[model samples]
Every structure is written in structure tokens, then in C-alpha cells.
Target: MGKENSSVLPVLQWLNRVVSEPHYLLHFLTFFSYFVIRCSATHILAPHLIHHLLQREIQTLLVFAVLALIKGVREETWEAFIADALFLAKICIFVLAFTMDRRLAIWYVLVFLVMHMLTQQPPFQGLGTSSKLTPLQLESLLTEGNTTRLWLVEFCASYSSGCIRSSQQFPELSITYSSKILSFGIVDLGLFPNAAEKFGISLSGCMGQLPTYILFDNATEVARFPELDFETTFFHPTVTKGLLSRHFDLDRSLLEYFNVK
Candidate 1:
């Protein structure tokens, strides 16, 4: 058990580093490997299987085309759910490509590269920055000297579609409501999965809960959103800026911050 954990830690750490900070050398290696993969696939698959794989790629493109058409039908109609769907579709395509066919996987990488260059935005990379908290900083602030303040910390993973959907909302809340007495922060579960164990969050995909919002008062968790529902089994009402405000009473917190003397 000790050896198993010892081996897993480095792999998770490396992934955290890559996602938090891009390494150009890794990109270069991946790019060079693309051609090698293409050559290998060319020899590995027969003519019929190659045709079938090509069809699969085309079907994937067609699905995106339909989604694009829907979004293009109206300019203002674009919503978070649509973006979420597109993101999830991209993830599905990514996983299926790697599992079903190598050449298709390389094809996705190429297309994603071009798309990323065009948009200057990539998936798995979060939208904006926030009052990000490391585990140590969080512990010190919550448990150490100061015991009068209130903190609303969002525990989230960068890779979670839910987190990506609500990324901008938390920062905007922090800007509008954050003061000396009350603060807003973000702890990326993707970067520090170890924090999940400490915070009592499950990293399992089956849980379907990545972005958990907790309101901490004087080192204790006073309130939380999407409070576990055993009947339905997940946090409901969908996380939004409005939801956060109401769930934690941000207006009251703001008023209290001003009243602090």
C-alpha cells in the first residue's frame, strides 16, 4: 500500500504541474510523437479499419457541426449550458480517440492545436484568476491567529465542466463582496487533489460533485452549498453567482464587513 501511494504521488504531481504551468518541451515531444503515431497506425490498421476510423472522425465532426449550427442560429442565445455541452463533447472525443484509434487521437490534437491558436483559449485551462488559496495558506488563515473573519472558499477542479462553467462568477463575487471581514477564495482540487482528503470531498467521478462551496467562519465550516442530499444524491439548484450570493447571504456579509469597526 505504501509503495502504491509513493508511485501515484509523482504522477499526480507531474499532471498538476503540467496543467498549472505549461511546459513547451512536453508540447514539442508530443508534437514529434504525432508523426510517429501516424506512421504506426498506418501500418497497424488494414484498409477497412482505417476507413471505419475515418468515418468515426467524420461523425464526431458532424456532431460539433450541429452544435455550432444551433449556436449560430442566434447570437444572444449562447448560454453556459451550450458551452458546457461543447466542453464535455470535446472531452468525450478526446477519450474515445485515444481508446478507439491512435490516428484519430493525433487528428484531434492537430485540430485542437489550430482551434487553440485561433481562440487563444484552451480547455482544461481555467478562465480567470481568483484569490487562490494553497492548503497551507488556507489552514493558516482559517485556524491560526485570525478568528473573526469569514471566508467563502470554493473547492473545485479545473477539469470539471461545472468549475469551468462557473469560473468567472466566483471572481466577480470576490471583487464585489470581498472586504476585510469577509473574503472569497478558490482552492483548485485539480492542482491539489490531496486537499480533497483533508476537506472530505470525493475525487471519484461517480460522485459528480467537483465544485463545492463552503462558508467558513472562524476556522469552522459554518455553511455549505449543495449540502449532500442522500435522496437525490447531489447538490441541487445549480451553482451560479446568484446561487452563491443567496446560499451564503453575500449581501449580509457585505453589510457586516462595512459595519466592522
Candidate 2:
């Protein structure tokens, strides 16, 4: 039992590290191996079976083409279908690469950027910056210490996607509410291990999970949100506002501020 546990522990730790940080080389090698295996499968398959499969797929395409022509498909409809087909093809490529070789998929995706870059533009320009808080600063703002009525502090890391998303929202949130009513602070866990340790937050546990939001009402924790919640809610202003509003008695005026009816 001890031997088995010891063997599994190292593998688990290795997996934890690999998942916690991005490794392009690891992804590339994995994908390349899968790609080679897939290529080898073609050589192993009987030529007769491959030919039969190709014929069947061609027939299916012809049937779809005929049906489209009979339906009087407009130019726009054809364009839309073509766009969807291209998107599906791209997804198939990404899936193949992601499953076997992720590094290639990440690079190959640049091919589609031309289309997206030509079509889309960013919606928001970002509002401003969130305040930075150190251990002493944070301790001073706790419930027992002199602090505002409501405070929200984000324990974040530079590498965390959720943290970056939350940071984008922080500027807007702080700007709308102002520091008097509701304030925002950020403590980078990587830079300040003591802060994370002092707050009983495990850095290893926080590797892939970050942007832990702790809402304090004069130092007493009113509400806390974990990484999973941020993953789902960070991108949606309405959903995020709803969560905060319910727990923190956030002003209804924020709805107007965000143009959410």
C-alpha cells in the first residue's frame, strides 16, 4: 500500500504541475505523437474500405447540395452555411491537435485570425486600475480594523486567466461605485506568498484556480467566491452584478451604469 501510494503521489504531483502552468513543448510533442499515430492508421486501413468510405461521404455531400438547390437557398444562406462549414472544419482540426498535439493547434489557429480580425472589434476599452494591497494594508482594512463599509479584495496571480478577466471588470466596478461605497484591491499571490499563507489560501491549490474574491464588511467576510464561479461569471457583467447585488446589497444604479435593463 505504501509503495503504491508513493508511486501515485509523484504522478499526481507531476500532473498538477503540468496542468497548473502552460507548457507549449509538452503540448506539441503530445499532439505530434497523436498525428503520427493517426497517419499510421491510414496506412493500416484496407484501401478498399477507405475508398468505400470516401464514396459514401461524397454521396452525402451531393445529396446535401441537391437539397440546398431545390430549397432555393439564397446567396446569404449559402454564405452562412459555408462559414459554418469552415468553422466546423477548423474545430475538427483543433480537436485533432488538442487531443494529440495542442501546440500545433494553438499556432495553426492563427490562420482563422484574418477572418476574425477583419470582422470583429473589441467592445469595451476598460475603465481603469484596481488598487493594490499588501499584507499590512489588507490587515488594516479587516473588519476589526478601520475600513470602509464594504470592500472587495481579489487574490490573484499574473498567469491566471480568471484573474485577468476579473481585473478588467474591477476598474469598471470601482469606477462606477467609487471607493467610498465599494472599493477594490488586488494582492498577487505569486509576489506575496505571505498574504496567501496568512489568509489560509494554499498556493498549490490556487495554481490553476485563481481570482479568489473576498468581500468584507468592515473586515468580516460577507461573501467569498472561488475560481470556478469566476470562470463562469467573470465574462458576463449581468451575471456578476447579480451575484454581487444579492450578497452585497450592491446599488441598483449599477444596472444603468452597465446598460443592463
Candidate 3:
């Protein structure tokens, strides 16, 4: 009789009992804390650090917990799905933006999308206007002669011979002289002669090549000038074709430059 009674108890009864238990609350809180920690660590601490951690067993456990939470939410509500999808989409967009050259329209779209997505909430309604400038506004600005064409140049200047020669004994990477050029005219102004000066690199000639060389060197130096010529070209629709073509070539150059191994 006892065995029969246990077997006959409804599944809902077991579920209710499980939910009412104190341990269930403890487990929920623990899982919640872990999720918060992972989210904060990934966004605030170091993205690469969290990226590495996510490749471990702990990340698997966290994913499981997140899945469990989604399941517990019960209803297949639109708001829930939309919220989750947006979160995932925002992450993917930003990741792609950071990984690729910032000059791409796709990168700008990602940034705007993330900003607009966030501003769909209260107290930040004007972000929609601030995050984007309309085509008409850009056109009027261009017609008013408020724009300038600039040239950028970059070159490898010098290297330490000792660092290069000691590849077997005390191997070190050689430092090369790099420069930039910025010209308002069609041709490089050549005003900046010293490659080592603070702004020696010309934006007109070599700014487009900076990322290619930096990637070739396996370095992150180009990130220092995030708002260089790319930002200036952001509002100019006419230059889109040229910019994209140059970017494609730059991608090829990056691979070729890095093949130095």
C-alpha cells in the first residue's frame, strides 16, 4: 500500500514540494549571483579575460543556469524573446565591430544599432537624434563647403640593429620609425617630414594603411588613433565606393604583411 501511494502521487505535487523547499531559493540566489558576476566581469574587467574563462567548465555551468532560467520563465512571451534576441544581437554586432576595421559602414551601423537599442528606454529618448545625422544634414553641410579632403601618410622609419641581430640570443622586436601625413589638398602636403613627430603620419596617403601594418606587426598600435580619417569620412556618401575598395585592398595587405614569418 505505501509503495502504491508513493507511485500514485501527482507530478505537480512533487514540483510544488520542490519549489517550496528552502534549498531551491538558495540555489536560485547562487545562480543569480554567478550570472551577475559573469556579466560584469565580461563587460567591465577584461573582455579577453572573460573570453578565456568562457572556454572553461565554469562557463558551461553558467550557460546551463541561464538556460534553466529561460525555461523557468514559462511563457513564450514576445517581450522575453525580443529582449533576449536584442541582447544577443548587440553582443554579436559589437564583437564584429571591434574585430573588423572601424572604417566600414557595418561598423558604424553596429555602433548606432547598439546605441539606438539602448535608447529605446526612458530618460534617453533624444539619443535617437544624437546617435545619427540625417543624409539631408550631411548634404547641406557638404554643399556649404564645410568639408575638407585630407591625406594621411605612414612609414617605417628606423629599427634597432641590436634588437634585430639578437634574434637567437636575446630576441626582440625592432622599433621602426612611423609617420603620418594630413593634407587638405589632392596630394600629400609633405608638410610633416619627421615620421617620429607626434602627428608626422599623413592621413591622406597612409592613414588607410595603418591598420594593415599594425596587424602585420601583430600589434595594437593603430587603436591609438581610433578617430582618425575614418571618422571624417563618416558623413560623406560619395566616398563610400572608394573607401570600401581601399578597405578591401587593405585587408589583403594585412595578410601579406603578416606573412613575414
lDDT of 2 at 89: 44
Computed on alpha carbons, the lDDT of every model, listed in order, comes to 0.67, 0.54, 0.32
Candidate 2 per-residue lDDT, tens place, 37-102, comes to 557746765887556645644564565566555443532222233333434445555655444446
- Per-residue alpha-carbon lDDT of candidate 1 for residues 1-261, written as tens digits (9 for 90 to 100): 999998688467545554554432344344455456656777787888777767766776677677767654532212344454446465556755675576777787787676555432223333233468898889888886654388889898866656655566677677778777787778888899999998877777557666788898888998886576654235365566777899889899888777774
Highest TM-score model number: 1
Per lDDT, the best of the predicted structures is 1
Return model 1's CA RMSD, one decimal.
12.3
Query: Clashes in candidate 1: how many?
Result: 0
* Cα error of candidate 2 at position 109, Å: 12
| Per-prediction TM-score to the true structure, in the order listed | 0.55, 0.44, 0.19
- Candidate 1 segments exceeding 4 Å error: 1-129
1-261, model 3: which lDDT tens digit per residue?
Answer: 998777556344434543564432333343344445445656564666555555543544466557546743642322233334345434443343334324533544654555454433111011111112232432333244333211121222112111111111100011111111111111111322343233333333233322111111221133222234665434322112134235324334434445642
Give the C-alpha miss distance for residue 108 in model 3, angstroms.
Answer: 41
Q: What is the full ranking by lDDT, best candidate first?
A: 1, 2, 3
Tell me the lDDT of candidate 3: 0.32
With candidate 3 superimposed using the best TM-score fit, by how many Å does residue 215's alpha carbon deviate from the native? 78
Minimal lDDT window, size 10, model 1: 120-129
Question: Candidate 3: which stretches are off by over 4 Å?
Answer: 1-14, 57-261
